[model samples]
Target: MIPLLFENLSIENQPVSMPLPNGITLTIKREDKNHRFVSGNKLRKLKYNIAQALTEGKDTILTFGGAYSNHIAATAAAGQAMGLKTIGVIRGDELATKIDVNPTLKFAKMCGMDFLFVSRSDYRYKHTPEFLEDLQKRYGSSVYIAPEGGTNTLAVKGCEEILTPNDAVFDVICTAVGTGGTISGLINASAPHQTVIGFPALKGEFLNKVINNYTNKTNWHLVHDYHFGGYAKVNEDLVTFLNVFNKNTHIPLDPIYVGKMIFAIFALANKGYFEPNTKILAIHTGGLQGIEGFNKERIKKHKSILDYEEKI
Candidate 1:
């Protein structure tokens, strides 16, 4: 057995110190430090999925995502660590030639995951029977498919462990939403006295429908205003916040997910969003490996550049 996934990675709740208008207390659930490769919510999402794959006697794992997807990189690393083959159905065909240039894909390639790059139009059909069948034909029957972002019932079950009995004291539990998998788990785990909020990384109305299909919990809410622009879209204000927050908390956040969620929480807190003495717990979903690509996009804005190790 690949031994890394068998380690008992501990989770910590670190308190955040900041000036707020109300008497609001904030803490972060440090899920990112769970593992070096399969860190953050990814580990939670993949825990049982990998078990199921093994129980089914699968020797290979197949999945889909964009070039910079944390899910793709995590899947590749996990499979290699677990002694299984992995295949990634990447969204852009042009990216096939840029594996060396893209940090996330570069790591996946290093872990021995093969790539099958497809056009954006073709990627939209990934869930359809025909597209999945084509994948099976190419990768063989030993493949176990992981839905993009590792969102599924098993993932939800793993994410529910994020909220311990101690978390019940917090009035609100917050996390960044990708495919609604992480939030769905939080919603399922939240106490009746608590509210779980999903701060989406992208602007969309369909998340409710997708999340609703997972859980029947009514204590959850989606905050749509914090996406900045859309998925992977970042502005100067956001870049500044990411840097400042890391400086203040010594915690790194990926621009796509955790960065935006933290920025929103601080802004709302400053604007008197929470009631006096409200307790909030922000989930630090890890995607720190994507900072290389994010900082490359900000090269024109920032004179300094961070290499891979330095970013980590």
Candidate 2:
């Protein structure tokens, strides 16, 4: 509401015409179109964070992320839109010189996010007081710090708003799990009969602890079957599926997050994972911003690139 960064964004529960089992149907919540830059869960996570920053009289916003992180790009644009100076603590120092070639970082730079590139080792201490103090020393302490991936209590509260009273009709709620904020919100707001499922973009059961901290609901479960070799990892098979999914549904998905979630959802639906007379709602948490970098990497590996977006 402060400077109105994302205005006129509302719930768009668009149904995807996927030919699944006869008893089940799949629909998608178009949270991705919330904003040009600050779209999807990124927008939800930033909603309260940005509001609090303004309420506290902070003039700057600082966040952490990887070179190709969607959070970094969204933060930079949201801060620019809200008239706040922004800083990005990038994980890889080497990417400092490659901003021209990196789409995510390039866009962040264009949005006026001051870049503080550090080595991977140094980035590991990003949570420690020493590291945070060093950052505050360089860029005033008034900077509202949104932790990497933008997953925090305030962010979780914003995400809980994703499901509306209309969404209660659906039997299952689904989302892609990154830092676990989106699904946690879904879990907290889910009806007793509604099951919340998370398709993790990264591997490991450690995210259970992260989600547990956000909500006390036990109706949610994470499907670890679709990591496809881990975070940011892709293959020819996945690319093939991505191309076909976009061609069929006309809903473009990012390689890292949405693609994996949709792929998993479709596979499960086809395999009769959903019982008869069941409805599944998946959150289209946008990350299409990373499509360019993902395609670039695919091209370098001599693999087919995902045709999710126009050439970068």
Candidate 3:
């Protein structure tokens, strides 16, 4: 029998409140604090992938991600907890002599994941058949491959569990789009009374194509303006917002993806895009460990001293 490490996830309905700028109240499902996986989204995406690996009689799993990818860390943890061997195909070739360990990578190593670094050019071809064949030859045929971010049809099916059925009507469902898996799944699971809004964390028009290719739904729209500088990049406003958000809600949102999404949601709501009484559920996709690399001083100089306070 496959181990049932993920069956006891706690579901907490996050608070709904009005924002300062526009006064439109939004309901947020803060799945980021679901468990040690750091987010409900991670749990949802990884649950079935791990199950499929074991069911198919595969003892090893191969996947792709950046050095700081939450998916990589989650995969490593899940693999270790589930008795499956894990290999992380990292983008970039600088893993050997890294001066400082990014927290995510450090945790992934602690989970017993083997890392293989590839060039940027080669990393782009990760989903190709040649890459899979090479990995199979290197790791043997017992390895099952999960796409980067665990964004697959099965992953989407897993994410549907995050949405709870409600009698109340909602106009829009918003989420940060990274690999487009969660948002695509949201689009699939949402009712016709709601429209799914995706805030893309990457550049270019490729996300639209990715979403379209995965699902035929036309109600989903991608907002490309609020990445705050691409994936893993941070700006002053985002940092300030993150700090204030953490202070107020005690919910830590990683500045790369979730932070940007929340920022965009506030911005759009303030601009009067959302009608009065329109319910908005912002899915907090989690990557809390990724926040370790952020320089608190550069973002909030006045409050940097708080970082030194001993936790009680």
Candidate 4:
């Protein structure tokens, strides 16, 4: 059954059509198309976690996430597919009543995920032993805890499969970092000659520690200039860039992660960040599932939604 989720995995490399400076050739690994529900890094992160849960005879998987988190959606779907119950410990208690209006939560509910909503303050202690003990008491011993954003050693092991021998030709490999799991795996698998660049979706010096906890590789570095005021924060320029980028390359980028990474890559290339004839491969870690909920919020605010929302 685990193999079923990855049957459609397609990491096809597609070149971007753009007038970039320094003769840097940009190509994207379409890991987004890996699965329908458990796409991209989410799928990779969840693969071994699910298997381990089943191996340990766990009947349920418990995790944490926000309203439109890709990890939440993917975990719910994986649980449903594997016949395991899923418990989502959501960040906002208010979102408990708003699931019907929120695409990610609603979809998770449809996939048989039960939610335990908590206030943001309480969510900070989610990894604490006392909080975990409480969860065990509430959900019983049959529950397996999958960390928020699904970033654990097992998840990193799964993500290590993201790179292949064919990717060695690229001088640089790039990906968007959230909790730093995917990039950690990429760093481990990257060739010594390849510099792995990470564009964080949020601003924090803490990510270095997070990434360091997972791998000992020294070929990776994070660029802090393009988070756009932090996680899930978007402006008009980003939206316009996403639309125009999709129109030009026919590749849809989710605003939270990949969109920012792509924008940064373009801006950096234009600034001559790479030398001439350098080949760069960017990983498209899919969070496109959240675009619907995001555009819904934009519509309610009387703002422009992503123009390519319908295309991908």
Candidate 5:
């Protein structure tokens, strides 16, 4: 059944006029409309991963993510739908705390995923052989390991399908760079005449190295100035942008990743980054359900201000 979803899916040509705050127009690809694989960029990445696991005769899959990770939820759903077992290695030691279990984690549990808690110190070594060996010892050796955020060579190969049906010419293809897997795949799949722009949603140079490590070509560029205070962090400007973007485009973008990337793309295009006639394709990686707990957490954390605000 899971394989059928991949076979029956078609990448919809989501067309929209992306307007910047400064009054510039850019054409955007609305990948969020492709809802077969939980919508957007994740669907493409998971297609190949799931297929590979099946091909290898692996019945169980293990991956890493944070408490609010969309990757975790998607993996669980994909596993259940495909008749495979899913294990999530969550970061941090607060897994037992009820308040720490966000909506994404809750849904992951409902999807029948087994959860394992790890310390922050150990999370840094998630990709190490020793850590994987321990997991194998516990969960059996048939389990396939997927890197955090599904950012690996195989993940990139899956993402390459994002541009397969593109008969239209594009000047730039833009996407949010988390582990850099999507952007790396975009670069690999893009026509030699096209350019790929990646917006880093996290601060620091970590993603730069990730991209460099996976990709050898230089057609892709990473922009780091518009993270909106790092991953999962948002402000009034971001909220305002998201509200307007959804109202205008009818596409809901999670503030942490896709929203930041869209925000940066518009900001850059407004500054004349592209020729007036250049077409830009922006990939929307879906994580809308992840926002349910995020907003609740924000309100709880800022109870003082939220209590006095006009009840919407």
Candidate 6:
């Protein structure tokens, strides 16, 4: 059996830059700093899944993702570190020849991940029986399929470990929702007195159902107004906010997940949404590896890039 690196990680709370209403205390749980590549929720999500694979005698882990997916990058890195093979079924077939230009794919390739590029239309059927059967036939039965965004029963179980006894002091636990796995785990683990709030990075009402499938806890709610536009969508205000927030706090936020979540938290704070003296803890789900790809797109459009790096 392969051991996980830094399996018992100590996540710290960094106070958000001061000057807030009602004297509310806001701190971010730095889950992003958990690992170099397989950081944040990815580390937590993949922990037990990889263990299960090893126990089942699986030699390869196959997963699905888009061009700039953090899940794809993290899965590859974790598989490499664990001495297992990694295969990424990328969403866009056009990205096959562009791997060198795509930062996320490039990094995954560097970690020894093989690619199976598929068309967007075909990728939509990733969960369908026919598509899954094709994958099993192609990769052989020895491969364990990790769902897109790395959300599964085991993934949620792993995410449940994100919060410890020390987190009970927080009145509100917050995290960015991708496939709702992380938030679901948080919901199940949260104290009855605590409320779990998820800020989605995409536009949709479907996540409520996705989350419900894993947890029966009623203390969680989703805020849908802060996605900017949709998944992987961004605007100038968000970019500026990320740069300025990092400048003030010296904590780098990936533009995709944590950046949007932190932005929404501040917006809610400014709107007098949080109660007086409420202690809010936001989980920083890492995807900083995608920053290079994001900046590349921004540079092509002659726009400002994310100014912070993980080293900060």
Clashes per candidate, residues 3 or more apart or on different chains? 0, 0, 0, 0, 0, 0
Candidate 4 vs candidate 6: the lDDT winner is: 4
lDDT per residue for candidate 6 within 1-312, as digits (tens), equals 435573779999888875678888889999988998899999999998998898999999999999999999999999989898999999999999999989899999999999999999989999999999989999898999999999999999999999999999999999999999999999999999999999999998999999999998899899999999999888999999988888788889988888898889889999988999999998999988888888999999999999874353
lDDT of 1 by residue, 1-312 (tens): 324584466789999865556788889999998888988998888888888888889999888899789999999999989898999999999998999989999999999999999999999999999998888888788999989999999899888888889888899999999999999999999999998888999988999999999899899888899898899887778877777677777778888899899889888888877888899999999998888777776686764433322358
Per-residue CA lDDT of candidate 3, range 249-307, in tens?
66667777877988888888778878876777788777776665454334454423223
> Which regions of candidate 4 deviate over 4 angstroms?
1-3
Q: How many steric overlaps does candidate 5 have?
A: 0
Q: Over the stretch 54-166, how does candidate 4's per-residue lDDT look in tens digits? A: 78889999999999999999999988888889999999999989999899999999999999999999999999999999999999999999999999999998899999999
Arranged by TM-score, best first: 6, 4, 2, 1, 3, 5
Candidate achieving higher TM-score, 3 or 6: 6
**Judged by lDDT against the true structure, how good is candidate 5?**
0.76
TM-score of 5: 0.89
Candidate 3 scores a C-alpha RMSD against the true structure in Å of 3.1
Score every model by TM-score: 0.95, 0.96, 0.90, 0.97, 0.89, 0.97
Write model 2 residue lDDT over 1-312, tens digit each, in one string. Answer: 534664456868888876777668889998887888888999989999999998999999999999789999999999888889999999989998999899999999999999989999999999999988888888886888889999999899989988888998999998999999989888998999999999999989999999999888899899999999999998778889988877778788888898888889878887878888689999999888998888788789788988743332
| Residue-level lDDT tens digits of model 5 in 249-310 | 66677778888888877777778776776677787777666667667887887731112121
**Model 6 lDDT at residue 179:** 95
Clashing pairs in 4: none
- Clashing pairs for model 1 are none
- Greater TM-score among 5 and 6 belongs to 6
lDDT of 1 at 10: 74
lDDT of 3: 0.76
